[model samples]
Target: MGCPLVSIIVPVYNAERFLNETLNSIKSQTYNNLEVLVINDSSSDNSVEIIEKFVKSDFRFRYFYNTTNQGVSHSTNVGLSQCKGEYITFHDHDDVMLPSKISSCVEILENNTELDGVITIAEYISEDGSPLGTKTALPDYITNNPFFVRAFERSYIPTWAMFMRRDIINKLEFDDNIKIGNQDADFFLRLLYRRPQLYYLSNPQNRFRQVSKSLSKKSTSTCEIYKKHNDVDIAKLYTQAGYSKVVIDYALAKANLWRENIESALNYIISAHERISEFDEEEKDNVYFIYATCLYLNQLFEPCLEILQKIEGKSFRAETLNNQGVCWAIFGDLTKARDYFESALSILPEYIDPKNNLFALNASESMPVRHFTKFPLRSVYKTI
Candidate 1:
């Protein structure tokens, strides 16, 4: 069979620093039947000049500039409306596509006619292009569950990791109003409602640059798209579409927690606990951590400690210890708190939570003590 054409939609903002490397990586992809739709969102930097250079030298690279600074969702939709490839994917202007990424995904789609799309794993990179590590592993149930179930758990499928048939473009568009930095997650969740079949490929790796000030981390509210769908409750819509109840609750809890809606977060997490038995050990630990966090925020220290103590796996053990230390400190047992903080540091020397807690403990000798509180969300720790 002849090679199928692939279209890559790249949304550019002020990405001049990494734009050249990003485009070069695409140009060097092993798969050659490709069209690059570089949508420039009126970048203030010299990103437009760099894009023009690639367009001039390569037949496959095409550039389109927005008249004004529309956000990523609008730019992505523009590329979606114009792209003519048999297969399509999205890329960020600052991230790199590994050499075999396109070819690997296309090969699987060609061979497995049942899969509507494929998602590959990614490695995290520093701004200087230093490799940090692989992104967190997906839950083990990803392969067998509906794509939305996995998407609900953590929104694992970013635009950069996803490759799909052009048909998906006709069914969905990026929500132009989703400004909370989870536009990709909103798009994927809506797509999952359509029940598209997808596969996760572990072999091909993409480089996802972890910007410290990325919008997702800095944005406090959940995406607007999740608030309503035709005025129907989003959770109700997903439930009608047959998504797992536990995952849906857990996801809502996380969203509410991000907005600091501690009461709502606690409510959703309690709902999740009704079917907590369905979760695997690690997944259960995730729910427990969120539950404990909500309790901690509500100042239910003893209940939070009880839940934190049930989490046994090493993945969250250190954070649990750090949180327990915070509870002890709040209860005015400085010695016990110090011991817990010290134990947490022993387990994870580089962990910032315990280190900060220990410092606070030491500083409290004469000055008024100010204790730090830790809330573990998946792999990230939020200290307050």
Candidate 2:
């Protein structure tokens, strides 16, 4: 037996500009046993001609075109319906996959039996493949942990960076409703909420092209329409992913729903009422910390103190002490806040949040500070 068969689905629409580079990247992957499916989703440009060119030139590629314009999810489902490989991955037409991408994913997935999927860090680049400073965390979006270095929250998780077992997605399909933006987020969140075994490679394997015209990257009015649709999927994901703490999830979900409801920054304060009753001491304290911060940011310190009081003098942990101190400082209790902050600082020097929050609190306190964990996080993936 040779290498396992892998199927790569490329959904195309008005991608004539970068289609060749994307296709060429797949063709040149170090892993040779693969099928490339290029679904031309009713392109209005020369994309059809470009697909035709690849069809003739590369025997490894097969081309399909829809008579009408279906969205990327539709095209993706069409490609998936045609897959016969043991493993499958999606490659966006405008992105580039490094030579190691396929081989490395193939290597890892073939060995790890429990992982439902793998994610990788990817770069933001202009149309010509020049890098932009924007970076995202793939593990954050993939894993269940928030505030962890799993995936970055600032940007989107590119569709091209995941390697998934075809069977895990068996009978599962992308929601066509999220047509314009965050299609990958919808898909991955569903996978994680339903299946808990997903892990990440932690390095960039795909170059996510941020061609200015890309709908997901736009800031115009049309993008607002796109964002509402994206939030729908996120809210759906939150229904289950937020089960552990509805209050925390509600705060995060509202933050996620920011575009649709412009006053979300205030709604987080309202979470105190929406939160489930009868929380344990720890649970209530955690919820209060998130609540106090939201109130402080929205300049509602009176309520912030109401929550902060519950956590103060409770003697939880160093981190908790620090958070309570910050809230008190915001509530104008400079003396009390400094005591808690100093005590927390003495207990845990490595916890940076207290240090930063305390410095911001006083604009006058001094402390020696260094942040690391012996080995800094260098790559999400270990090298060969």
Q: Candidate 1: worst 10 consecutive residues by lDDT?
A: 375-384
Off by over 4 Å in 1: 136-142, 178-180, 211-220, 223-261, 271-280, 362-384
Best candidate (score: lDDT): 1
lDDT of 1 by residue, 116-136 (tens): 888777888998889988865
> RMSD per prediction, one decimal?
4.5, 10.2
Report the lDDT tens digits of candidate 2 across residue range 61-114: 888889998788889998889988888899888888888888887777777767
Whole-model alpha-carbon lDDT for candidate 2: 0.64
Question: Residue 293 in candidate 1 has what lDDT?
Answer: 88
TM-score of each: 0.83, 0.62
